[model samples]
Every structure is written in C-alpha cells, then in structure tokens.
Target chain A: MNEIKIFSPATVANVSCGFDVMGFCLDSVGDEMVIRKTEKKGIHITHIEGFNLPYETDKNVSGVSALAMYNDLDLDFGFEIEIYKKIKPGSGIGSSAASAVGSVFGMNELLGRPYSKRQLTEFAIKGEALASKCEHADNLAPAMFGGFALVKSVSPLEILEIPSPKELYATIIHPQIEIKTSESRALLPKEVKLEDAITQWANFGSLIHGLHTNNYEIIGKSLKDVIVEPHRSKLIPYFDAVTKAAINAGALGSGISGSGPSIFSLSQGEETAINVKEAIEKTYSKAGIEYDMHVSKINTKGIKILN
Target chain B: MNEIKIFSPATVANVSCGFDVMGFCLDSVGDEMVIRKTEKKGIHITHIEGFNLPYETDKNVSGVSALAMYNDLDLDFGFEIEIYKKIKPGSGIGSSAASAVGSVFGMNELLGRPYSKRQLTEFAIKGEALASKCEHADNLAPAMFGGFALVKSVSPLEILEIPSPKELYATIIHPQIEIKTSESRALLPKEVKLEDAITQWANFGSLIHGLHTNNYEIIGKSLKDVIVEPHRSKLIPYFDAVTKAAINAGALGSGISGSGPSIFSLSQGEETAINVKEAIEKTYSKAGIEYDMHVSKINTKGIKILN
Candidate 1:
C-alpha cells in the first residue's frame, strides 16, 4: 500500500495511583492522518489542519517521531504525512502522544511492518519528549499497544498490557485551558513521605489485581492517588467538585487525566460513563469554564487504519 | 465441633517490590495447635511445648488473638489452646502470625465460622501488632486467606487475595539470628526519593499483573525491592551473596523474607526451588552460620485440620 490513512487514538496517563507509570487508550477521541510514499529519501510534513502546529519537519512531533524511525532504516523511499489534528495540545489527554505515535505507526506499516510495537513506542518517545521535555512511556505505551498499559521501567522499556474489562468506559472533560506537561511536572515534590509512598504502591498493586479479577468494587476502592494529586490538583480549578460529582454519579473513580485541566472518570458501563460526563458538564459549566467532553469505551486496539 | 486441631501455615511478607503490603503462605513450614471448647468464660492457654512462651492469655499471641475474637462475640463457651510452637520468634518468617491466625481460625471453625477470613484477619492484626508494634496485615492476610495476599491498607483493613501460579514453590533459609520486625522497620528512611518510589510502585503493579497472568519471566523481572531492601538487607549477613546465589541457581527471585535473617526465594517449579535451597545451604555453610531451611509449595489453603 503506497498510500495509507490511519486514526491515532488519544490516551490518559497517570491513572489515579499509577503516577508516571500507567495509562489507557481512548476509543473515539483521536486524530486522522494520511501518509503517502515518496521517491525523495527524507521525511516531510506536507500539510496540517485544525490546530496551529509547525510544518517544519524538526519542529513537528509527527515529523520528529517519523524521522527517528526513518533515519535508522536504509529504505529506498521517503514518506509525506498530513495530520488532521483534533485533540488539543496540553489538554492532558496525550495530544502530543497521538501525533507522536501516529507517524511511526504509519511508517512501520508502509515499511511492511519492519518494527515491533515496542520499537514504535521508542520512536514515539522521542517525539513525546519534544512536548513533555522528559522521556516517559505512560502515554506512548497505551497509544501503541492499546488497552491499559503499565510501564514497569523506562530505561529497559518494559511495558505490561493490563486487561481492560469489556464493560469499562472512560468519561473525559477537558476544561479549555493548557497545562503544559513540563510545568505541571515541576509542581511535584522531589521527596515523598515513606508512609504515603507505601499507601500509593498498595493502591497501585490492588488496582492491578482488581483489573485482573474484574471486580469493579475493588477497582473503585483502589482508585486513589495519595502522592501526586495533592500537589497537582491545586492547579486545576474545581478538581475536587468534578471528582466528587463523578463518583456520586457512579463512576468507578476519577482523577487528573495526565497533568491537569483534563479530568477523567472510569465507569463500568457506557450509560454510567455518559452520566459521569453530564455530571462533570454540570460541575464545569457551573464553574464557568469552557470545556470539551467525551465518553468512550476503553480502546483495545491502539492505532487503526481508516482506509 | 467441640474441639479442633489445626495446622496453621507460616507466611513470607513484604515480597520484594510489594514491601509492607504483600505476602504468601507456605505449605511445609508452620505450627500445630489443639483448640478445645471449655465451660469457663475466657481464652485459656493450658499446655505449652516446643518453645518458651507465655501461658497468660494476654501475653500469648494465640490467646490474645483468640480473646479479640472471643470478646467481640457473646458466646457461652470459651476456648482452651494447647501450644505446639515449631517456628522460632524473630526469625522473620511470620511466626507470630501462625500462632495468631491459628487460634482465631480454630475458634471461628468451632463457632460455626461466623467471622470471615477478612474479619479473622482483623482479629489477627491485633495479635500481630503485639509483636511488630505496628498494625500491618501483610503476613496475617496470607496466613488466613492463603496464597498471595495484598493488604492494600490497614486502617480500613482491605485485603486482596492474589492467585498463585500452580508451579510456583518457595525456598526459605532461616539463618539462626534474631532481627526483630520492629527494629528492622525502624531502619527504613522516613522519606524516600520520588523517583525511587515511582520505580517501586511500577514494579509492584507489574508483579501483580505477572501473578495474575502466570508469566514467570515478568514475575522474575518485577521481584525487585528498591525502597526497603537496601537498608534492611544490611541487617542480614550474606544477603547479597544469597540472592546472587539463588538467582544463579535458577530461582525466579530472592529477597529478605518479612524483615531479615530469614531469606526466601521463589522458583517456577519444585525442582528449581530445591536447587535454590541447595545453593543457599552451601553459601550459608561456607559463611559458618547455623541455619534451618525448608522447601514448600505455595499453600493455597491457609489453615488445615490435622484432626
């Protein structure tokens, strides 16, 4: 296939207790991209739509990520990419990750599947670093491998794909404000109390167990972030009210999607997710903040071919 | 129904990455007790054997735990417990937990099992606190519930029972030295680096995923303790050497069991577990330390009726 069209999905990182390590893919919210083979032996971002982003190859996340993969391969041909961006940058739902993951995924496909998903994630991380200014796979893994992803370590790049329950759905509310990943990350403390760290890890382990067993109650109980949320939540307006409202509306749990501004709730059913979305809409609307909302079933497949 | 004889299993708590939250029951290493229904109104410690311990109800862990459950219920009959202590105290192998769980399990059995394993664990925690000087259910949860157990929190008393892979076996070496749980616990830093804590929780979540999926390689990779082991291992002689030896001998992983002095290794099969046992025995023999060792399958059932 000389030309291909793909849909790269958005992702939610730092799922409650799994700060810096966990993330999950979204089904409906994403960006559409088109890639075509070219005789010229280099990468190019020919066109872009719906969001102001650089067209320069080095400056664009898709260009940077695709170049990272393209440079290593001794291919006879190059590729041109066009992104129809939908996810807003710095909305905390892995906007950069969608762009970053899209190019590499498209290139690997056009190159006759030369790289593994893990290898594609490595290329995506370079692009992601352009936005976060740090290397983390929390978003990249789920965006590549789909479903729930737990990054055990970054150096060796170990990512475990956790099973998503069939009935699980995600409700996301993006309050139309930018919270840069680097700036939000800087708000965290360098040291945490050993007691609080223990609590955090316990919750993380329990949440993983709950996912494996399909126990919604256990999953709900374990969705607590004792370490990072206390400091970061202060930056997001009405964070507590939205969380309380989502939980009261029967979400399994609610927390910051990535860093801030974008809040997410996980529910056992689509109806409950929609209810959580309405509750968040009411809460955010009352707060007088312009916001975008989405309700999606957990995406089991990451990047999909639109063609 | 009147009298019950029980064999309560030993447990290894703080399984590597799951420090302060995870534990697993052992099949061959445990203690036996005979609990009899008495006409008198309180817990009684009638006979003692195998080890020096208190006869007073309040001082003995078994009697203390039994009393905690007994007092909570308005029952006509009291319990008479005869001690058959086989596990050594301060050996870091949940010795107190075995005795503590034994009486409560037997009483609940005789009392028609009114208390759940979770409730029995609550009673057991009171007895465990008498030894550790802290209310933690890492050991008690496994000794009561059997298999791998993760105590998510002690305050609300949440315990999750994790599935044990069928081929898994444990090799434990008790290097005849005393390291009190309270003393070893004090060795930990009041604060830990945020990066290390993140690594710890990542490993913990991955370990739980490995257990649920029965992926032994992931289990081996995840069996790491970054926060607690570095300081605690210093308290145990030849800890580094034992761990190195166990891994070299095909053990999945090794670490300080519970607190210190006693070291444990997990292996995929009984043959590998026995091989790990030999490696540890040989290493300790050269180090000129007197020690006792046992090889046990993962005890899926916590307590047994020996009749």
Candidate 2:
C-alpha cells in the first residue's frame, strides 16, 4: 500500500436518557486522517492539528487506534499518519472515539479493506477504552454504524443501530469550562433506590417510542437523566438554564451530552435548531460563560474515505 | 337511548419496564357492557357474573366507570347496565381496566357517542383511580387503545397510544395469592438513586427499540427492572424462581405483571410461550401455590361493541 486516506466523525455518547449505553456519530465535522506507506513495517504518527497536544504516536489518539490494529492482527505495514483535528480531545463530543476510530478506519483502507466495519469498530473501541478510561461502546457504535444506537447490556454485549429518524437536528453548546469524564462519573452514587428507577424506565421507553413513531414531543418530555446528570450537572455552570432555554426555544429535547461541559439539544427542524442554538448561547451568556454551539442535522453517514 | 351495547377489552399494564405509566387494551377477549333505557333516570346494575357479589351499581367496577361518565356529562338518562365480567379481578390481567373501560364505552353508546376514545379513556382512568387508588393510566390506555401504550406523564395527565408492535406475544402467569395494588404500592420505595434510575431508562429505551425493530434478543436483555421489581418482588413468593425458570425455558423476557402475584413473560412465538408457561407453572407448583397462565398476542384492537 502506498497511501491511505480516511476521515472519522465526532460522536455523541450517552445521548440523554441512554446513559452509558448509547451513542451516535455525526457527519458534519471531526478529525482528519492521512496515512502514507513507509519503509518500516511499524506505525508512525507525524502531524496533529487543531489543538495543543503531544505528537508521539503512542500518546496520539489516531496512533493508539493504529497500534491496536497492528497488535490485534500480526501484520507489519509501516505507515506514517497525520491527524488534522477539528473536535477537541476532551469535549465529550467523542474525542477519544474520533481518534481511535480514525486509526482503524485508516488502517482498513491501507490494508485494502481486510477487516469489516464491525471488526474495525472492535479495534477502535479498544483504543477508546484506553483513552476514555471506560469500557464503553457508545461512541464506538455510532462511529461504526452511523446512526441512533442502543446498548442493551454490556456484559452479555449487544449493540443495536436504530434508523436515523426523520426531521432530526442536533444542536450542541460546548462551554469553555472543563469537566473531566472521570470527575463526572465519580460524583454518581454507587446505588439508587427503587422508585426513581421505574420513572427512569418510563422515560426511556417513551423516548424510544418517540424515536420510532417520530413523536418529538414525547421524546422531548422523556429526555431525563437520573444517573449522571443530576450529580455532574453541578460541575457545569448554568446547566439547567441552558437546557431550559433550549426547551423554551422549541428544541424537541435537551440534556447533558456525554460528560458536560457540553450540552446537546435535539430539534425537529432547521428553524428549531437555530432557535435552540440561540437559546443555548443566550443562556450561557447570561451565566457569563463563553461557549461554542452548532446547529446541524443528525449525521446520517458516519465515516467517509477522502483520498 | 334504548338497547345500547358497548365493549371494553382486557388490558396489559406495566409492559416490563413501564410500571405505572403504560397500558393497552386487548380485542375479542374482554368485558361486555349492555345498557338499556329505563322509565326513570335512576341507575340500576345487574348480572355481575364470575365474582360472587350483589348487584349494587356503586360498588361494582362497571358502576364506578358509569358514575364518572354520568358525572362528567351532567346527563339524565335512566339506565340499566348488565356487565358480563369476562376478565377475573385480582388476576393481574387488568380485569379492573376492562370493567372501567366497559363503563365508558357502554355509556358512550347510550349517549350517541358524545366523547372521543381519548376522552372516554380520561373518564376510564378516573374509574381506575377509584379502583387501584393510583393516579395512572397504565390499565386504562390499553383498555382504550389496545397493543402497546404509553402513559406519557401521570401528573400533568398525558396518555399516549403508541404503536402496538408486531411479532410480540405476552405470556401471563396468574398465581392465586391475592396482593392488592395498594399493598404492592406500599412495598415499593419512595425514592431511588439517580444512577439506577438511568439504567432503567436505558433498559426501557432498548425495550422500545426491540419493539420497533422486531428484535427479540434486545427486548429480552432489556427486560430488567432495577426499581419496583427488586422490592415489590419480595411480596410475591417464588418470584425469583419463576423468573429464572421462565428465562431458562427460552422465554425472551420475564417480569412480574403489574402489581403481582402474576408474572408476565415475553416471547417471539408459540413455542417460547408454551415453554414459559410450563416453566412458570412448575415453579409455582414447587412453591405449592395455585396459579393459572396464558400465552397471548399483543391485542391490537382496543374494544368492540359486541352485538
């Protein structure tokens, strides 16, 4: 192989009510990958763009994914990789997933598509596990399947790709403040009582119904996170205010996207998307916090090859 | 109005993870209601079969629903109602819902159909509130809409008739040890930790996904309840054993049906249904408890006016 070209999209993990067990990848933007064949049959990472970070392939996200691919399959193919990063490292927009998935996707192209998409995802998740510090597949799934997904159980292991709903818009607000996923998770209690759990299921069920039947109102009403959001919400300034504004601005639903500092809102159309984006920005402004927000449709396509 | 006939079907509430907020009515097999015009505007009840009781209308389940209709409309129509109680009470098969919905359906026919099905459901839920002492539409929605239903929010009062999934069969096991709905409510905890609640939502979402996509494995895996099932299950003897046996018997999913004494298992076909029934009965027999079981489909039609 002489040259390999690949691209991976940013993913949204733990989409509201799905908690640790769900994710979806977007098509609008993510990290870029450029892999070139080398004389040596080992992975080498050369360039990283868009954020301050290290250049070592071992520490690089793309490098980690490439490493997992090399380690899993006893193959020697020397490749120099360059990463043009758009999504940040810890923005909760699937930074780790982007890198890991990028490497696997790039390698698949270089190896003349030896592994299937599922196989690439498996290796990508391994890289993600090391970087995200959790044995989760929410980000990995969307990176692989490219749409709404559900992780039924982790131990018995099931990942389902739900069809991308019609009239789906993604509105995200990334506050400049940093809240690590580890800290967000640490705040959650070890055990929960029985009553609240029932409500959670009810909400979850309604959300799924909303997705299937295109009942946006039900989805909006049912988007509640009893697990991570309540405790970790304190870490993010004006979390409630931003969500309230999004809902008020006619967003179908809004909640903490992965481990905030980033909040994502779903809207029914472009009009609502813009409205929600403005609402979120205004709310953050009121709270005296600088943030980045984007209003875009749900990415029907996950990753693409650009040669 | 003279010689009016109305019908309401038996309903399945709780739907695995949706404890108190989901329900739908069955078709063909339910309660029958017949109303006749009398000389005076006074109400009289007769022919309460299956349960040994006197025929005073107020104490009757049909009478409760009738009362709501009569009160809500402010109408003066002397009526005689004969209720054919097909679904047995305290069976955890939504017997009360059948009667309640029957009342609304019968009265609507007598009044020349003044109310919509949703309106009748609202009236019917009031009757359920009287019977179950819980403010929920779990049984009523099913009684009105059939198939799968969602009680969107219990407080602000929303009941949604969602899609009834195809290729889904319900296996209900009715153990003849009476535990009232109030008693089940008393057993459950008032509050739950945030995290467990979120898992419930994830399971719930997966359950809906399974229903939407016709994926049985996901439904089975997502049938877990972290809240009410753990605590309230203690009240039902052999609850754990029956659940284990049902799963082992190739049922896709198993859980206590509503506020049981009754356990419900979900499967894709007749073979799984038969196996679940055998497994459940075996457990109950070992526990020395008398019980009955049924393998039924998700009844799509809500209710019908049987001539």
Candidate 3:
C-alpha cells in the first residue's frame, strides 16, 4: 500500500487512581493522519488541517513518530503526511497522542506493517516525548492498542492491555481552554505520603478488578485520586462543582482527564453517559466556559484504517 | 448453640507490589478458637494452647477481639474462650491475624452471627492493634473475607475482595528467625521516588488484571516489588538465593510475606507449589537455617465453623 489513512482515537490517562500508569481509548473523538510514499529520502509534512501544529519533520509529533518508525525499519522510501486534528491539542484527552500514535500507525501501514502494535507504541513515544519533554505511554499505548492499557514499565517498554467491561461508557467535556501539559505536570507533588500512596494502590487494584469482573460498584468506589488530582484539578475552572454534578447525575466516577481543560465521567450505559454529559454541560455553562462534549462507549479498537 | 468453634486461616500481606494494602488467605496454617457462653458477667480466656501468648483480656489478641465484639454488640452475657495457636507468633505469615480473626469469628458465631464479614474485620483490627499497636486490616480482611482482599481505606474500613484464579497455590517458608514487624517497617524509606512509585502502581494494576483474568504470564511479569522488598530482604537469611531457586523451579512469583522472616511463592497448581517448597527447602537447608514449609491452594474460605 503506497498510501494509508489512519484514525487514532483520543484517550483518558491517569484514570483517577492510576496516574502515569493507566489509560483507555475513546470511540468517537480522534485525529486522522494520511501518509503517502514519496521519492524523497526523509519524512515531510506536506499538508496540515485543524490545529496549527509544527510542520518541521523533527519538530512535529507526527513527523517525529514517522521518522522514528522509518529509522527503526531502515526504510529507504520517504513519506508525506497530513494530520487532521479533531481532538484539540492540550485538551488533556490525549490529543497529541492521537497525532503521535496515528503517525506511526499510518506509517507502519505505508511501510507494509513491519512493526507490531507494541513496537509502534515504542516509536510513538518519541513523538510524545517531543511534545511533553518526557516519554510516557499511558496515552500512546491505549491509542495504539485500543481499550485500557497499563504501562507497567517504561524502561523495558512493558505495556499490558487491561480487559475493560463492555458496558463502560465515557462522557468527556473539553472546555475551550489550554493547560500546557508540562506546566500541568509540574503542579503534582514531588513526594507523596506513604499512607496516601498505599490507599491509591489499593484503589488502583480495586479499579482493575472492577474493570475485569464487570463490577461497577467497586469501580465507582475505587475511582478516587488522593494524590495527583487533588493538586492538578486546581488549574481547571469549577472542577469540583462539575465533578460533583456528574457524580450526582449517576456517573460511576468523574475526574480531570489527563491534565485538564477536559474533564470526563464514566457510566454504565449510553443514556447515563448522555446524562453525565448534560450534568457537566450545566456546570460548564454556568461557569460561562465554552465546552465541547462527547458521549460514547469505550473504544475497544484503537487506531483504524480510514478509506 | 451454646458453644462455637472457628478457624481463621493465615494470610500473606503486602503481596509484592501492594504494601499495607493487599493480602490473601492461606489454606493450611491458621488459629483455632472455641467460644462458650457462660453465666458470668465478663469475657474470659479459660485456656491457652500452643504458644504462650498473653492470657489477659487486653493483652491477648483473641481476648481483645472478643471484648471488642462484645462491647460493639453491648452484650450483657459473658463468654469463655479457648485458643489453640498453630501459627507461630511473629512468623510474619499473619499469625496474629489468625488469632484475632478466629476470635472475632468464633465470638460472632457464638453471639448468633450479628456482624457482617466487614464488621468482623473491623473488630479483628482492634485485636490486631493490641498485637501490632496499629489498626491494619490487610491481613485481617483476607482472613475474614477470604481469597484476596484489598484494603482501600482504613478510615471507614473499606475492604474489597479480589477474585483469584482457581489454580493459584501458595507456598510459604518460615525460617527459624524473628524479625520484629516494627523494626522491619522502620527500615523502609519514608519517601519513595515518584518514578518508582508509578512503576509499582503499574505492576499492581497488572497483577490485579492477571489475578482476575487467570493470565499466568501477566501475573509472573507483574509480581515485582521495587520499594519495600529491596530494603527489608536484607533482614532475612538466604532471601535472594531462595527466591532465585523458587523462580527457577517455576514458581510464578516469590517474595517476603508481610514484615518477614517468612517468604512465600505462588504457582499454578499443587505440584508447582510443592516444587517451590522443595526449592526453598534446598536453599535454607544449604544455609543451615531450620525452616517450616507449607503448600496449599489459595483459601477461598476465610473462617470456617467446626462442631
């Protein structure tokens, strides 16, 4: 295939108790990338759409990811790529990951699918690093592999796909604001109390169990962040009011997605998801913040080919 | 019924990556308590068996647990309790938990089963506090609720029972040595690197997934403790060699059990558990340390009543 079109879904990282370790894919909101083989020896960005991202090969996330894949494969051919960013950048719902993951995913298809999903994720990390200054796979892994992915170790690049409940629905609200990923990350505490850390671990363990066993009650009870969110949520407007509204409206759990400006709530069914969206909308609307809302079931399939 | 007999199984706390928050029950080792109603006005310990534990109501774990339950229920009737302690004290295999749990369990039965398993765990925590000077339920929860239990919070005493695979077996080795729990706990660093903590959470998340899904490979890979084990293992003789031997003999995971002079390994079936026991025996025998070994399937039933 000389040309390939790929769509990489948005993702929610941290997932409350699982900071820097867990994430899950979304079905509806995503970024699209088109890659076509070229006679030139290096990757190039020929066109851009939606957000104004860098076009330079070394600077753009897509270009960086494509170049990494190309170097790993030792491919002789070059590729021209175009990115249509639908998941707005810096929304904290894994916007950059869609670009980074889509680039490697599409490039792999253009290069005859030489790399596995795990290997593609590894290449995509370089792109994520370009954007965030540090390589993290919590977003990239789920965006590449689909569903819930756990980054067990970054050094050895161990990523495990956690089995998610089928009825899980996500409701995300992206407020028209930007929270720079680096600055948002800097807000987290350097050292966490050992007591709080143990509680977080227990909740994380319970969350995983609930996801695997389809126990929504356990999931709801365990969906608490005693560490990161307590610090980072301050950056988002009306975070507490919005989350309380979502929970009162029957969301199983709610929290700032990734690093905020986007907040999400999870529920069991589509109707409840829609209700959660409405609840979040009421809060954001009252706060006078323009927001985009999406309600859909979890994306079990991550990146997919687009005709 | 005027008299009731109860057996509370031993438990292994920490479980590698989940320090102070996770534990599982053992099938073979435990404590037995027999409770009988009396016309007397107060709770009493009539007979003590095995180890020479304190017989005072406030000092003995069994006596403390029974008194806690009696006070909670506001019962006017008196009770006489007999303790038969098979699990060694300070063995780090939750010996005190077995006594505390068995006491509350037998008392609950004798008092007509007024308390839920969760409530029983709460009362048992009081008993554990009498022994350890802190109210912790990692061991008590599993000993009360059975299988694997995660103590998500101690404030309101929230415990979640985690599903375990049927073939999971535990192999425990108690070397003839004493490592005070307080001293071992003090050896842990007060502050952990955020990076290592994140990795630990990932492993913990993966371990939960592995347990629920019966995925042995994921369980084996995730059964790593980077924080507590590295510092505390120095207190146990032949810790490294025994763990290496167990892993080489096909034990899926091995680590120090709680604050230990005891170590445990987990495997798929009874045969593998026996092999792990043999592997541990070889190492300890070579080191000239007398050790007691027990291999059993994961205990699904925490406390059982006997005639």
For TM-score, the strongest prediction is 1
DockQ, cand. 3: 0.73
Candidate 2, true inter-chain contacts retained:
0.72
Write out the backbone clash pairs for model 3: none
Question: List-wise, what DockQ does each model earn?
Answer: 0.96, 0.54, 0.73
Better of 1 and 2 by TM-score: 1
iRMS per model, in Å, is 0.4, 2.7, 1.3
Best-fitting candidate, scored by lDDT? 1
Once fitted onto the true fold, the runs of candidate 1 whose alpha carbons sit more than 4 angstroms away are none
Q: Kindly list the per-residue Cα lDDT of model 3 for residues A1-307, writing each as its tens digit.
A: 7898888899999899988888999998998888898888889998898988888999998889888888876656788998888988888889888888888888778767888999998888999998888989999999988888989888789888888889899999888887876778789888877767777888899898888878898889989998888898888889999889899999999887887878889999889999888888887888887888999789998899999
Question: How much of the true A–B contact set does each candidate keep?
Answer: 0.99, 0.72, 0.82
Q: Assess the local accuracy of residue B285 in candidate 2 as a C-alpha lDDT between 0 and 100.
A: 85
- Worst 10-residue lDDT window for candidate 1 chain A reads A177-186
Q: If scored against the real structure, what TM-score would every candidate get?
A: 0.99, 0.91, 0.94
lDDT tens readout by residue for model 2, B1-307: 5776766776667766677776645543577778786766756786666666447767766677777777776655567888777777887778888887787787777778899888887777776776777666788777777777777666666666666557677777778888976787788776775656666677777777876777788778878877778888898888888888888988887787778777888878777778788878877888777777777777877777767
Runs of candidate 2 exceeding 4 Å displacement: A37-39, A112-116, A191-195, A226-230, A282-288, B24-29, B53-56, B180-183, B191-195, B278-287
- Model 1: residue A236 alpha-carbon error in angstroms: 0.5
